[model samples]
Target: MLKFDHVSKVYKGGKKAVNDLNLEFNKGEFIVFIGPSGCGKTTTMKMINRLIEPSEGTIYINNEDIMKKDPVKLRREIGYVIQQIGLFPHMTIQENISLVLKLLKWPEEKRKARAKELLSLVDMTPDYLDRYPHELSGGQQQRIGVLRALAADQPLILMDEPFGALDPITRDSLQDEFKKLQKKLGKTIVFVTHDMDEALKLADKIVILRGGQLVQCGTPDEILREPANEFVEEFIGKERLVQAKPNITTVEQIMNPRPITIMSGQSLTEAITLMKQHRVDSLLVVDENHVLEGYIDVETIDQNRKKARLVGDVILPDTFAVEKNALVRDTIRQILKKGMKYVPVTDENNRLVGIVTRTSLVDIVYDSIWGDEAAAE
Candidate 1:
């Protein structure tokens, strides 16, 4: 949906911020632009909305040249998000989110409804609509920034390190959340980040830049498997290269085939006994046919013990799980990135087959990194 044709941006001096970038991004694709300082990733993204005008060549959005359009009107039709969040502290969350809609002269009731609908996408409650930006956490504020970008339902969005200021845990959560949202909405995104992990996790295609030029552009796996040059290889780092090796093992190979589990119909007393016997804080709840239902933990059981009887009554049904045939790398990313203790593995029928724990991953990672050399030694 976005194309960069022989694009070049040169400041007043002889410095070229972007040098002849020729690239095209497809619709609904998550495109990440990444590089070191002064590499022109941000400059390239800003040029999309005419925030930074190109000194040479043309940029087209769906075959319409962006430079030909009115800069202000073009910006309004596109979404832009920055690292600083840029939310007005005085404005309520609803007002902040609907800022663009208000500019479009949308009716008050329509704007309010839009804000509510957008907030629901991130699982935020309607009560937040009336609260000011200062009342929300930093992560929540960043979320608001994203919502503001999506306020007008723009087909293309530009994000310049939008999560750079957040803590690592919050950043990972937002990355996962935003990736899911992008898939659901199917908006073409041009994101700028220096973080390779973030680029790999979020981008459908990665555009790596250096010295104000495109060094390499490919999927994360492609770049990892066969880096174009020494610069690209070094930038990707050796650890990631090793981790992305071809013929990588699958989750089923490393997962524990028999995890501690209990029937949904089992009594709370029985659940407690099972937990104690297995020395586990929780037990996976499965049906008689071994289909995954959910899970019950010691804390959950204790909290509901007085009011609840069966394991099914207290089970938390929203447990994150993985398919048995999933790649080990993906499973590791899900568990480590989300900070989960373990992820249950299920078969095609949703039957509980196994579980992968953090400890198991640690061993597997060590082996992947040094097993051959260690064996030789």
Candidate 2:
């Protein structure tokens, strides 16, 4: 619900911070602006809330020019968050979150209810409402900063490197948490970051900038698969480039669709027969409807042949499975980390659809490493 039409920001001595940028953001989009330092990504975002006013062209939020609106009123309608997480140390968490509501003259009880509700959104308990900012950890305080922004239930939120100051682990956690929160709340977010991985993970659309101008703007997959030019290619890095090859991105593209399976009610003798017939050591167990139940292996069948009658009685129900649409890279990571031989692929309803084996990943890994050079030879 935001549009930048030929927008530019020129500072004193006529140095343009943002150069005639034109972009439109849809409702409920998670848009990230990213580039090298001093590339004007921050300035572009600040101009949205009038933190830094644009020098040329027009910025419209919901078709209304921001310049015509009162600055304070406009800011209250849009949420702003920063890396420092400016939660007032003197104010209690409840007071900090309810600041906007109080400024709007909301009733005391209504404000408290709003504060409590906002706290719950971030997984904070109501008891935290009475505590001061210093009592919480950095991550908690940052979460509070986000909650305060959401406190007013605004449709648009501007975030300027909100997770940059935290440690890598905490930063990664917050990125995932915020991405999920954005999807659940469906708030239009304009996030600014220097980290490409973070932008790729969190953004619905990425706006890349260079020398205060729009270089390229596209979804992560689009930019990764086909970079606009050498500059964009260098910015995305060679490792990411190889990993995001369009042909082998998703599990569905590489997984074997016809995995050998045995019915859960089938006898252990039949399970062995099926495994031998497929020339495989293990078989995925499924119900009559093709819904995945678990798995049975030659070893398990051999060990329990005399004791267990049906495959269901000896089946191992803790098999790991990935959804068909999961990224192959992600599935590979999980497979390696868990030391899995193969992973079952399932649809949303957990019906067995395909399987990804370690053997299947060897070619992908080789291709990612050698790239087109190997194919050309």
Candidate 3:
């Protein structure tokens, strides 16, 4: 929806902040600008809404040059949110949020109604609308700041690290909430952040810049699997695959869902029979409840072949474990940390659902990047 065409910006002191940059932001695409502090990302963003006019080229919004439009009118159409939040201390939450509407000369009743709706949309309560900005938590205040920017009902929004100041947990929580809000109200967002992880998590298209120039722009997976250059590779690191997501991969998706099973009190012969029938190595015994009791692998059964003990008698609880919906990296890290062969997959209530062995993870990674048929070949 917005395009920066060969835009260049030089300050009065003759320092070049943005070097001839040509970029296009797709409609409703959550694009992120990331780089070292002096890389001109901030300058590039500000120039879009004419907060900082280009010294050379121009920017366009829907084929209309922004330089032609009145700055105040252009700003009203493009929401602006900065790191400081800049909430006016003198006004109540409702008053602060409704600042744009009031300025637009809307009726008092209309402004008040909009104030309530926008506040609620950002997940803040109506009761807080009467309260001052100082009365709310840092995160709450930041949320209010976002809501206020959104109140203008603009087609484009520029957010400059909206949650950069919060603690990790708070920042993560707000990012999640913001994601949901964006889905419900699909506005074109241009966000600037130093946090690569946050950018990876949220960006539909990530724009990397260095030394006042564009480096690369692509989807999260694209950057993760294939970085543009040596610098991009060194910057992103090998952890991108793991860092791109949190605990979301289903246990069943990465687990050996079907394992050889022996009855609660089955004999060693039964253990061997189950393993052979399933063409597997172990006999996993579970009671009627489906809770993981224990396992008797082929090695154990072979060692005690002459004894022929019941599966329960030979079962060992030491090898059992459960981690549900764990990230593949987390799963492998925990498994390697404990020096274990397999980890069970359980629901939130901790009942066994499946088992994730080292084999399962490798298979999953292989199947995902390369096709299943390709892997088979």
List, in order, the clash count of every candidate structure. Answer: 0, 0, 0
The lDDT of each candidate is: 0.91, 0.90, 0.80
Checking candidate 1 for backbone clashes, the offending pairs are: none
**Superposition error at 141 for model 2 (Å):** 2.0
Q: What TM-score does prediction 1 earn?
A: 0.85
TM-score for every candidate vs. truth? 0.85, 0.78, 0.71
Off by over 4 Å in 1: 264-285, 293-320, 325-327, 337-341, 348-350, 366-377
Best by lDDT: 1
Tens digits of per-residue lDDT for model 2, 206-238? 999998999999999889988999998998888
TM-score-best of 2 and 3: 2
Model 1, 231-321: lDDT tens per residue?
9989988867776766565888889999999998889999999889989999999999999999988998888879999998999999889
Q: C-alpha displacement of 321 in model 2, angstroms?
A: 6.1
Candidate 1 residue 100 C-alpha distance from true site, Å:
1.2
